[model samples]
Target: MRADSFFGKLTRTLTGDPGPTAPQSGGTRPKDLRRARLNDAVLAGESLVGALLTDAGMARANLSGADLTGADLSRARLPGANLARTTLVGARLVGADLKGAVLADAELTGAKLTGALLTNANLSDAELTDADLTEANLAGANLTSALLGRADLSGADLSDAYLTDGHLPNAKLRGVDLAGVNLTEAALVDADLTGASLTEANLGGADLTRADLSGADLTGAAVFEVRWTAGTRWPDREVEERLRALSQEVEPGVWTVVGDTGRSRGLRLGD
Candidate 1:
C-alpha cells in the first residue's frame, strides 16, 4: 500500500508498457495501490479492473473512455482530467478534485462524489443518476442536458453552473448555492430546495412542479414558464403578491404568468 507503488502501476498501465519489475497480468501478487501519486497518468481507453486508487493524485490525467467501474478512488486528485465517456458506476470518489475536467457523457450512476471539487467541469450529457454529490463544489460547471435524476446535491455550490435542459427530478438541493445558474427548460419536479439560494438564477421555462422552496431566495430570478405549487415560497411578501397577481390558472394544475410583462404570457403552476 505504499504511495509510490500505486503510481508505478498506474504509469505502466497508462503507457501500455509493463516495466521490468512490474507484476504479471492475472497474478496473485498484492500490489500497494493506496495513496498513489499518479499525476498526469494517461489512462485513456484503458480498462482498470477493480484498481485501488484511494487518496491518489492523478491531476491532469487523460482518462477518456477509461473503465473505472467499482474503483475505490476516494480522496483522489483528478483536476483538469479528460474523462469523457468514462465508466465510473459505483465508484467511490468522495472528496476528489475534478476541477475543469471533461466528463461529457460519462456514466457515474451511484458514484459517491461528496465534497468533490468539480468547478468548470464539462459534464454535458453525462448520466449521473442516483449519484451522491452532497457538499460538492460545482461552480461554473457545464452540465447541460445531463441526467441527474434523484442525485444528492444538498449543500453543494453550483454558482453560475450551466444546467440548461438538465434532468434533476426529485434531487436533493437543500441549502445549495445556485446563484446565476442557467436552468432553462430543466426538469426539477418534486426536488427539495429548502433554504436554497437562487439569487438571480435563470429558470426560464423550467419545470419545478411540487418542488419544496420553504426558505429559498429567488430575488431577480427569471420565472418565464416556471412551474410551482402553493407550497413554494417567495423571499419577500411583495414578490409573493406580484407572483400571485401575475399568475393565472390556465388549466387544471397548471398556471400561466407573464415574464417582464411582455406581449406574450408565460406559464406557471397551481395547487
Candidate 2:
C-alpha cells in the first residue's frame, strides 16, 4: 500500500467524508507526517496499519477501535486522545505523549512503547504481553485486569497506577516504581521484580508464587492476604518477619496475611 493512500483517508476523515473500505490485511502506509498538526481529528475506527506518523500533533483526536497495528508513532503528541479497544499490536510508540488518553481493553501485544508518556491514561484490561514498556511514564494510569504476561517494564514509573487483578506472570519489572498502586488479587507467578519498589502499595490477595523479589523495597507496603509459595523471594529476613507477623497459616503450605484492624478479611494461598 502506498503512503499517499493513508493521507487520502486522513483527508476524507477530516472533511467529514467516509474513507474507502480498508483492505483485509496490511492497510495503507502513511507518509512521513512528522510534526503534522492534526488536532481534534475524527479518526475513529480507521485502519491505518503501518502509518508513519512520527512526531505528529494529534491532541484530542478520537481513534477508538482504530486498527493501528504496526504503525510508527514515535515521539508523537497524542494527549487526550480516545483509543479505547484499539488494535496496536507491534506498533512503535516510543517517546509518544499519550497523557489522559483512554486505551481501555486495547490490544497492544508486542508493541514497543518505551519512554512513552502515559500519565493519567486509562488502559484498564489492555493486553500487553511481550510489550516493551521500559522507562515509560505510566504514572496514575489505570491498568486494572490488564494482561502483562512476559512484558518488560523495567525502570517504568508506575506510581499511583491502578493494577488490581492484573496478570503479570513471568513479567520483567526490575527497578520499577509501584508506589501507592493497587494490585489486589493480581497474578504474578514467576515474575522478576528485582530492585522494584512496592512502597505503600496494596498487594492484598496477590499471588507471588515463585516470584523474584531480590533487592526489592516493600517498606510500608500492604501485604495483607498476600499469597507466598516456597520459591517466593523476600527482600530480607526482617521483611519476612514483618510479613509473617501480620499473617497466619490457614493450611499446610498456605498462608493468609491479615490486616491489623481486627478484621477477618484474608485469602488463602493455593485455594
Candidate 3:
C-alpha cells in the first residue's frame, strides 16, 4: 500500500479513532518491512495502549510521554528512541533491542523484558519495580537512582553499568555479572545475589541489609563504609570478620563503618 494509506491506518490505531476499514486483498508485508513503515509513522506522545507492534523497527523514533500500557512490542528494535517518562506498564518487550534508548523516568512495572538488549541505554530514575529482565544485556547502561525493587535480573550482564544510588531491594540477581560496577550509595537490601560476580565493584556506602552474598565473588571489590545489618549474609567468615572489625554499632540492629574521607561515606541501618 501507499505510505499515506499506511500512515492513516497507523494514526487511527494509535489514536483510538474510529474510521472506515478496508480489507487488503494481499497479505501484509514481512514483519521487517511493515515494522519499518510503522517506525516512520509513529508520532510522539501518541496513545498506543495494547498496540501490537511486534518486531517494529523504531530505531531513533521519538515516543516520549506515550502511553504504551500492555502493548506487545516483543523483539522491537528501538535503539536510540526517545521514550522518556513513557508509560509501559505490563508491556511485553521480550528480546526487544533498546540499546542507547532514553527511558529516563519511564514506568516499566511488571514489564516482560527477557533477553532484551539495553546496553548503554539511559534509564536513570526509571521505575522498574517487579519488572522481569531475565538475561537482559545492560552493559554500560546508566541506571543511576533507578528503582528496581523486586525486579528479576537473573543472569543479566551489567558490566561497567552505573547504578549509583539505585534501589534494588529484594531484587533477584542470581549468577548475574556485575564486575566493575559502581554501586556507590545504592540500596540493595534483602537482595538475592547468590553466586553473582561483583569483582572490583565499588560498594562504597551501600546498604546491604539482609542481602545474601553466598558464593558470590567480591575479589578486589571496594567495601568501604558499606552498611550491613545482622541479617546480611556474607560469603565467608574471613570477609565477615574483616567487615565487622571496620564497622561499629550505631543503634539497635544497626551497624556502620566510618569512611576516611569527606562526605558522609558512613553506612546507616534502620528498617
Pick the lDDT winner. Answer: 2
How well is each residue in 66-146 modelled by candidate 2, as lDDT tens digits? 888999999999999999989999999999999999999999999999999999999999999999999999999999999
TM-score of each: 0.84, 0.86, 0.85
Looking at model 3, how many pairs of residues clash?
0
All candidates in order of lDDT, best leading: 2, 3, 1
Which sections of candidate 1 miss by over 4 Å? 1-32, 230-240, 260-271
**Pairs of residues at least 3 apart in sequence or in different chains that clash in candidate 2:** 225-257
List model 3 lDDT by residue over 45-136, tens digit each.
Answer: 77677767888888888889888898888989999899999999999999999999999999999999999999999999999999999999
Worst 10-residue lDDT window for candidate 3 reads 27-36
Give the distance in Å from residue 187's predicted Cα in candidate 3 to where it truly belongs. 0.8
Better model by TM-score, 1 or 3?
A: 3
Q: Which ten residues in a row have the lowest lDDT in candidate 1?
A: 262-271
Q: By the lDDT metric, which is better: model 1 or model 3?
A: 3
Q: Quantify all predictions' global Cα lDDT against the true fold.
A: 0.82, 0.85, 0.84
